[model samples]
Target: MNENKKTLGELLNASYSAFGYAIGFSCLVNLLMLTAPIYMLQVFDRVLPSQSSDTLVYLTIIAILAIIVYGILDIARAQVLTRVSWWIDNKLSPIALAKSLDHTLLGGSYAAQSLADITTLRQFLSSPSIYAFFDAPWIIIFLIVIFLLSFPLGIIATLGAIVLLSLAILNEKVSRKPLEQANTLHMNNQESISNSIRQAECIQAMGMMSPIVSKWLHNNEAVLAMQCTASDRSGIVLSFSKSIRLILQILILGVGAYYVINGELTSGAMLAASIIMGRALAPAEQAIGAWKQAINALQAYRRLQHYLSQPETRPPEILLPKPQGRIDVNNLLYIPAGAKKPVIQGVQFTLMPGESLGIIGPSGSGKSTLARLLVGIWPPTNGTVRLDGANIYTWNRQDIGNHVGYLPQDTLLFKGSVKENIARMDKIEDAKIISAAQFVGVHDMILHLSHGYDTDTSRYHLSGGQAQRIALARAFYGSPALVVLDEPESNLDQEGLAALELIYKNAQKSGITIIVVSQRPMLMKHCNKVLVMRDGHMERFGLYAEIIR
Candidate 1:
């Protein structure tokens, strides 16, 4: 708890009124819980001894009304708890999703598990077993009434409570370690299964399914063994608690009978004492029975608290004006998410608005890193990449993305119509979509499809070259001021290459800046300047004619 920066209790306290109301309902319900034994006591002691039909009728009527009100209170409490859980879910679901995505982008664990944790907490809130925790304090309340009957009875009930409570604590201590181990084992197995499914094609081609299955089973068996250990340990305590409760309850009657024979208690008082003692011990017994679930709930709560403690990435302080495609890098450097040394070090360059630069490098020469930095996909390790005089990383990414275009080596389309993909899923414009497609020479190919622009392109059903052309069309959409294409023609054929050249001519005429990262020099013919990189540093940067010479 000292190590935790935020806690489940704090999150619950944020919804103070809802929790307060639920607790209020619990108090009311527990107060009403006293109704049953009291009603039985009155019938056995007062009404029957009085021998008046009217007295019996009146007492019975009052008891029935009290029981009805008790039922109502229980129902109301359940509804309140359910709503509180709903309010929590509605409030935290979106925030958790956004936080999870941001963390993932920064190389943190996936937050989807937090959603599952929240559901587990919601179940804990609504489960009938949960009411035991709330009712626990009322054991003293019940014991006080027992004391009013006889000192001996009060002592017996107190001892019973202590014993049951001890069993609950024992249950927790016995199961905690194994339960924690089981949870860890479960997570490892889940990750293994997810990885196997994701790489199923590779596994199939390599015929490694049998070996993977054996590894998965080994992980699963460890989890199962821990689960069995926890269950066995908790089962012993749970069974012992139930046994003690029954024995003490039955002995309460015997003790009460002994007192009754000595005129210390009445027959009615003896029966009432036994019933009240069971009522008091029932809660602890229920808790003992569910100790394993309680441990899981505790783990889930801590996981969520740790996740919530992580600071969220803030949005831009204020929206900035649109930037022209003038890029300036000063002593720029980059290191991957988890690495010891920089991948690009002390590299610097500048490109004026409307300038076209071609980036050529050997494999692992940091060309892709340079392109990503220029587009503000990531922040630099040191120094900065500025666009139009302000640091590009300081600007709002969503706002700045409006003016940037990129074609990554890997092109992925969402489950949407061709027009939507071209428009980057923003509001559709017929002219912009058609013009971009025509710019990439995919317009005729699109029209030939059955649904033309409205076709659902979930699977990239077209040929590889055709898919690359569509991706190129997307990059050219809206005539973004700066276009960065990282190996854009890797999958394009001669016709697609011609379309690429046409886009360059058209973009050059329109004065849009372009940066193309490629290994092959086929498209360098269209570049006026070239930058060469070798071993994470700039090797040469000059006019195309000079560099070629």
Candidate 2:
């Protein structure tokens, strides 16, 4: 029940033509449903009184035809609604994902919330929450029709419905606070459970099973107590409202019966009036349910809106074409949040085209940050990263991606064949694929696989070092102008490290600019120069011997 910053009207406005058509179809279905009861009353009051057998037969045939038509319309309406929901889900998912990625790259604190909010929003979109829009409008229309048919009776019924709705709203207001508390407790309990599972091995090793289990149970009990209390409050209110509505219905029926007996109204008219009252009241009850669902949907929408509002780390821009890769950081400055001083303050460096530079530093130094800045993962607080005298940020994201290749310490491989993982399903010839794998020292491993390059990596996996090599192969697959590797030899043994050194030599030989961040002295030996960093600032830049000394 949080106040929605973006209203339902705004959402509808943002929706495409298909959404409008779906709503129109749903309304037509409701119109057909309303007609069925009216048609029934016509047959009972007018057609039957004529006492013509043929007329009765024709009326019955028409009613049956209307029923069939209504059924078909209902089916089509459901189909359209389903499709609309799917379309919204599909369109919104990518936008949500992109926003989350942008926030993460920007070092936004709410990145995790962005992911959770997107998931909840998608669920709301696909659930009964959206259908409530169709139902609520139809219910209002039904109530209006009933009011027109019988003034006094409709007024009485309307009063009863208003009372019921008011009570429901009051109940919602009273229960929402407790429901929120219960939900908070539930989330805390879930987090505790997840942490317990993730640290099961450590817990067992420390023999703290009893303490962990006791804590988990305590949290679970607290969550359960909160949930039960909330549920009881909601149930009591709903039961009371339902009872009042039932009493109102009985009173209306009794009044109608008395009027019929006193000859103030005909028997058929009384029956029709009772039927209309029920139809109108039924929609009111449905509307209450829809209102509850709307609250949840609105909450989900608000969460998504918060995610979408986060600032982008690297705004999308178009970069001018460069003939060669010449990286220059002019008075680079990076100040992480809550830090007193900027990392890499007033740092400046320039690398000519095809120059291979190595960055070496202790842990927690600015080596990785500098590498990230060079790759455009983070923008400097002050200063600029330029390629061929033009700011890299000015380039289109896709263009930067095509020109620069980055390999992080933790390489993630998707579930696919080696060929698909390496080639990325591009139309690369086998010879090129083999050459790239060979250049990265993974060619022999691929040859040994059951299907060679076609082997399903998802079924049979590679070790960490092998995976890193494959990742390296993929990064260098397109022969990007600038290749940045962070801790390339961290997981590799001596043999693998030797293989990587050869790969680096070959890359430099091919006139591709290479920048590597590593702690290993052996890797730095092959570089022409080494850049040393400490505490987010560059300390030295010189030959490997000079820096080591």
Candidate 3:
């Protein structure tokens, strides 16, 4: 990933057919554009000498038609390029999103960074500027045309181009270190600012506003200093390059004047040569800048690729048959990354169909981790988690997802209508959505809104409890075989908690296996059995009364 071993041509070969076609069309348009100067020169030098009114009129019409043709080609090329960009973006977005989602399921520090890098790569790759490779080759074509027209003039143009391009490339290299640093610092500053604003009330309550502001200001100052230095250096380099290019241009014209005096070149030819030289050199300037940005984009891409290539906890091809609403963990020893001790050493548990199990533990116990493993969010390090006697890791990811519903501590609600949030998919029936919401005690809340289920609650109108209930409704909407709830009772009031208990009871009667990780004793009271964990190890597994005793 650290090596830059491939050219843009090789990299783009991985793109789809539509992308290739679009790039090809863009190149064609650029080649066509290069011919316009040659045509103009021919008209000025040859057609004007005849000086016939009809001939001049005809030539003018031809030139106008050519301009119109060029305009059409340019428009077509732009349209094709846009389509390619959209196609590639759409294709890559899902892969990047899926990788991020998968990383979330397998939590770790590297996983977190991998998700962020995927997002950045998606954004950078989707930009239209990344596909500038198609237009770069036209610079060579322009130079060749200039050489064919006048060799000495072409040499001067090439020399100026090299100088300007070298300066641009060097400028890019010098700025990269600072630019990368500035970007990272800016992200840190933004995070600090966001944290400060989000916890402004807490800061004021604790009289810690000064400290929070100071930290945020420190991050901001670092970012600003890096940006200022990079910008100043870039400006100086650009100014110098422009000055040198202008001098080279003047020298070329002075040499061309000598050729004209020797009757070796026409004024129109010299003018055309200059125009072509500018056209030839412009893309070189663009390429220098593009190459710099591309390098940065590629670095981000390598990070993203590493994430996409990470091994999942379970492979997709492996198949675990649908369970009979039973789960078992036999002598399971769960060790998280960088932990010296297993979280759930020698933990043995089993649940029959229609039975409800409650997991209870203090903070730092492995209650949540156990629930995650049961639901196949992660694989055990030293033992097997079984579903109906089939090892859970043998189950396909989609199959496990379909049968096991997991609700984490934090409930995420998307910005949409209440119905959209509840259904989660367009194909979900309205009646099913209503029933799920009603069962979870959020139907009444929805009905009270202006549009009932159709009401948009994206403006932070819903309370934490309301959002949690909605999330629960979504989880239960499909009637999964097993449901794992982590801290589901945290934000609920007494009535809401009672409603949740009733929902679980109903689910149990329907033969669904319910596993809850909760700190509340009241919630545990309803369970048939309770598993108590301490210091990442299960201390007891028995009925609630037995465990309490």
Candidate 4:
């Protein structure tokens, strides 16, 4: 909401302009608060004493108009609060989503919790409970009005308001920590369930479904216990606040009657004092009951603030002009996630356009790690991976992606059509999709499916080799300047192997740079050069024929 700065408060305050209007409306509504008691007083004192029918008629009509206006103002303020909630949803949800995405990329679960926090804040803003706090300050105004009517009445109302205020404060103190603890337990419970669902297939394969379910239930029960404890305490506080408010109203009425009997007050004044005293305590009682929601909203606001305090990630910068597919890796090293030792240690290589390189290494030799580094998936620990003399890591990633193709060892596909999968979910152009599929020799395989290119891949199961080839088509969807494939033929049969060779032959002729990592020596035969890695260190780098010799 601020041009030179941004914070959760600023974004939330952007909606308070509506509250500004609502507060102005609230002033009129509070003035209208005088309607009921004053209406009763006029009927009792003025109409009965004067006994003029016309005076009675005029007063009744005027009171009706005041009540109607009060109703309208109250409705307008509620609508304004509703609009404030809408503003928060529309404005903050996207920012929260982006921040959540950053967390997801850094190995955190998808930012569902962050979005949930925003939703909690939005609901609190829109709920009627929020109006309790908004109306709270007016309690003093009503007490002051009562003071003007009679000093004794004012003193009684003041003591009642103080008692209600004290109860509200006590409610906050008693409930705050338990509510926060319940919320934390609830989050942990949800996360445990999410983990079970995400890895359900593994659990099923391992025959551990029952145990996982029992574990989830056990965690959830803990949350329920915490919630029950919090609810019990809050319920007691709410009951006490309500009882005190009703008792105070009766006490004010008794005092007002006593004053009237002593010739210090009139009958209407006695009734009005009781009316205003009830009105004065109503907001505090409401506030005491609404403290739970206030605590929840406050916690949510703090979480959002903590999320925003993390380093912000901005959109990609300018994309470099299309380059000639040259890759420069200088003193590259990488320490993988949750590991202390570097996975690729001081390994560097460069491949010119139209050249093909093969990386052959035993298991745990960092071949896949190097492939990942070359494609800009992981930043190197020590040096740079430059594509066309600019660091690809800092490039406008989506634009640079147009010229880069990558096939990680483990393939992935979202739920979509076969054509969509082949095109990486881009606009499905028939020729492009089929050409990529044909290059990987999955064209005929896809056509044989129940709906061919339009088939929903989620409902359609592909064998290991079939899935691998389809993923290959995806990596080749666009005309990429650099192609890095890790274990491309891991699941492929003899026919699949030939198709991969043809794909590489095409890349060799088209001046596209290629890097392939494989365990099979047959797959590395066509490479003009070879690199051998062992235990994160490059053992050999030279012409393929010479290295073999």
> TM per model?
0.88, 0.86, 0.86, 0.88
Better of 1 and 3 by lDDT: 1
List, residue by residue over 39-69, the lDDT tens digit for candidate 4: 8888888989989899889988998999999
**Every candidate's CA RMSD:** 3.7, 4.3, 4.2, 3.3
Query: What digit string (tens of lDDT, one per residue) describes model 1 on residues 359-475?
Result: 998999999888888877777888898878778776766677688899887777767988999999999999999998987788998998878999889744777787788888898
For model 1, the run of ten residues with the poorest summed lDDT: 1-10
Per residue, candidate 2 scores C-alpha lDDT tens digits across 1-549 of 121224333444666566676677667766666655666567666777877778768767877787788788766666665666665566666666665675667655454454555455556555554654565555566667655655655666778767767766776686666666665566667766776887887999999999988998898888778767766766776677777778777766677677667866555555565665666566445545444345545565676676555444555455567437788989999897677777667668888778888898898887888888888777778899887777776566766766787788667676887877777566767776777788778888778878888877778767788778777888777667888899888668777888888978887787778899998766787777788888777789977678765
Superposed Cα deviation of residue 353, candidate 2 (Å)? 1.7
Off by over 4 Å in 3: 1-23, 34-36, 108-133, 187-210, 288-292, 318-322, 424-426
The TM-score that candidate 3 achieves is 0.86
| Candidate 2 error regions (>4 Å) | 1-19, 47-50, 109-132, 137-152, 178-230, 290-292, 309-311, 424-432
For candidate 1, give the lDDT of residue 269: 81
Window of ten residues with lowest summed lDDT in model 3: 1-10
True lDDT of residue 364, candidate 2: 83
Off by over 4 Å in 4: 1-13, 108-112, 313-316, 336-339, 419-435, 459-468, 490-498, 526-528, 546-549
Candidate 1 accuracy as lDDT: 0.82
Clashes of each: 0, 4, 1, 0
Model 2 per-residue lDDT at 117:
52
Candidate 3 structure quality by residue, lDDT tens digits, 387-470: 887777657766666677778877778788888877765465888898878767778877877788877768648878877888
- Those runs of model 1 whose alpha carbons end farther than 4 Å from true positions after fitting are 1-13, 110-112, 261-263, 313-316, 415-479, 490-499, 502-506, 509-511, 546-549
- The CA lDDT of each predicted structure is 0.82, 0.70, 0.73, 0.83
Model 3, residue 142: distance off in Å is: 3.0
